[model samples]
Target: MPRTALIVIDMLNTYTHEDAEALVPSVHEALPGIAALLKLARASESPVVYVNDNFGEWRSHHGEILRAALQGRHPDLVEPVAPDENALFVVKARHSIFFETPLAYLLGQLGAERLVLCGQVTEQCVLYSALDAHIRHFDVVVAADAVAHIDAQLAEAALRMMSRNMSAAICSADGITFDARRAD
Candidate 1:
């Protein structure tokens, strides 16, 4: 069985952006599911990778970015999903996690043939990242309940596209299994 890695996209957010008001409620609803998946992945020793936006901070690294988020309006949301010391971190400047980022190479090094994507902007980052992952030949799974969004209708459409177009498995977080040794 191929190894599965959890790719958490842009969840380490400050929630101070223009769409923050529209996005916060969804994040609150999705927080528990994201937290659950993080716990499962950690316990099973599956790779936990955090692919976060740089927020135009050219000098900011993972720790700095995380610190800024913790200091943001919604530290509560940021805390539960914060990366542990063993977790891998990749900084991105765009919507897709793979866009001009080292994520593809990093996943290759970790031998992650399947990716479980969880995080914010269901209609944007998560959607774009799913397409990029599909093009890269990685089996994509989107934790439906674990992803937040700015627009509910667009998010629903994005999930449909992911399933019908990209062949991504659109299921709840509880439906995900992290153990590579177990039969699917």
Candidate 2:
């Protein structure tokens, strides 16, 4: 059986701020799908990984990113969460979560063969992660309804590119089903 995981990338207070948030309600529409996936992951005891951008928080640290997220300048945009202590997080300084983060090692450790990737900025971080994960040989499933972009037009283009460039299975969030876990 292949172990599966749900990865929610970005969706931070920095990217999603109130002004920008108001401008792009499509991002907000993604919330229910993400929440449902998170709930299913929790119920199934599957790992829920948060691959968030550090956004030049270099001078501080990952902890600082968390603090800034919970109570900071961009809380409305970022929408930081009190992540369950059990969940894994990779605070990324670069666009892709796999870079400079222990995501690959951790995913290998968890024996994750199938990954459900979701998050903000379809053209950048989310796109990079999906492609990179496919490169690393994980069966990638991208929830189309779970990704958002500040530019709807660009977001649509990104989706088309992802659907073509990567071996990512595109499915509506409501249609996802967690198959029984497979042994690695």
Candidate 3:
């Protein structure tokens, strides 16, 4: 049986960017769902991969990156869905998690055929990552309520594109089932 991996994208944020003002509220709304998904993934012993932006801090590793985000203005946003010790961490410099990253190789090594995606910037990182995941032939599932966005309209359009163009499963976080024995 193929394993299901939970991909948490760009959730480790500092909230110091120019668009942070517009993005924070959306993150607030999406937090509970993201948190719930994390809990479920962890409980099920499924692979939990956190693909986060490096924020131009090229010198930082995963722990340093996480530390910086936690020390940022909105630590509240980073706390709930923070990566646990067992979670896999991938630092990305661009929007798509797979771009110039070892995520594809890592996923293949873990035997993750189905990916449950959740996290911030729904129209940007999440959207692009979904497309990349689609082309890679991984079964993509986007937790609608678990993704945050900078623009509501663009986010909705992105979700539509993922569903229509990429054939990604768009559903609530609660709608997801994590059993590796059951095909999604």
Candidate 4:
């Protein structure tokens, strides 16, 4: 059986970037789904990994980042999907979670052969992360409703690329099942 992991990417953002305002609505819509998936991931004994952007804070830790984001422009986005004590946290400097991070090693340690990706900027970070996961030979299952984007059109295109080129399974968050007995 394939071991599955949930990767929540870049949702701890401050939303202070140039394109942040435009993406707020979509991010708001995705919050509930992300939260629900987080609950499901925890209940099933599956690993819940948060791959967050460090935002150039060399000295920043996960708790510091979470606190900052909670006090940042949009706390609603960060607060709902905040990482818990049991969730594994990996800070990344770039778009891909595997870039400059120990994500691959952590996944290896957890024996995660399949990944359920959920988070912000569907056209950018989420897309790149999915590609990297695919290249690493991991089965990718993107929680479509749990991902937000800056541009709707580009986000759609990115989803298509993930489905066509990378063979990622795109489905709603509620449809995602982490049951260990079933084949992913």
lDDT of 3: 0.93
Extract clashing residue pairs from model 1.
Answer: none
- lDDT tens digits, residues 1-184, model 3? 4588999998899999999999999999999999999888888888999999888989999999999999998999999988999999999999999999999999998888999999989999999999999999999999999999999999999999999999999999999978543333
Q: Mind giving the per-residue lDDT tens digits that candidate 2 earns over 1-184?
A: 4788888887654543444654347666777777777777777778888887776666755566667766754454344333566777777877787988899999998888889987777777778888889899988888888877777787777777777888688888877766554544
Ten consecutive residues with minimal summed lDDT in candidate 3? Answer: 175-184
Candidate 3 C-alpha error for residue 156, in Å: 0.4
Per-residue alpha-carbon lDDT of candidate 1 for residues 1-184, written as tens digits (9 for 90 to 100):
5799999999989988999999999999999999999999999889999999988999999999999999999999999999999899999999999999999999998888999999999999999999999999999999999999999999999999999999999999999999744433
Give the Å shift of residue 183 in candidate 3.
Answer: 17
Q: Estimate each model's TM-score.
A: 0.97, 0.84, 0.96, 0.96
Candidate-wise lDDT, in order? 0.94, 0.74, 0.93, 0.91
Give the per-residue Cα lDDT of candidate 3 at 20.
98
Pick out the ten consecutive residues of candidate 4 with the lowest summed lDDT: 175-184
User: Order the candidates by lDDT, highest first — what do you get?
Assistant: 1, 3, 4, 2
Query: Number of the top candidate by TM-score?
Result: 1
Model 3 CA lDDT for position 183: 32
Residue 10's lDDT in candidate 3? 89
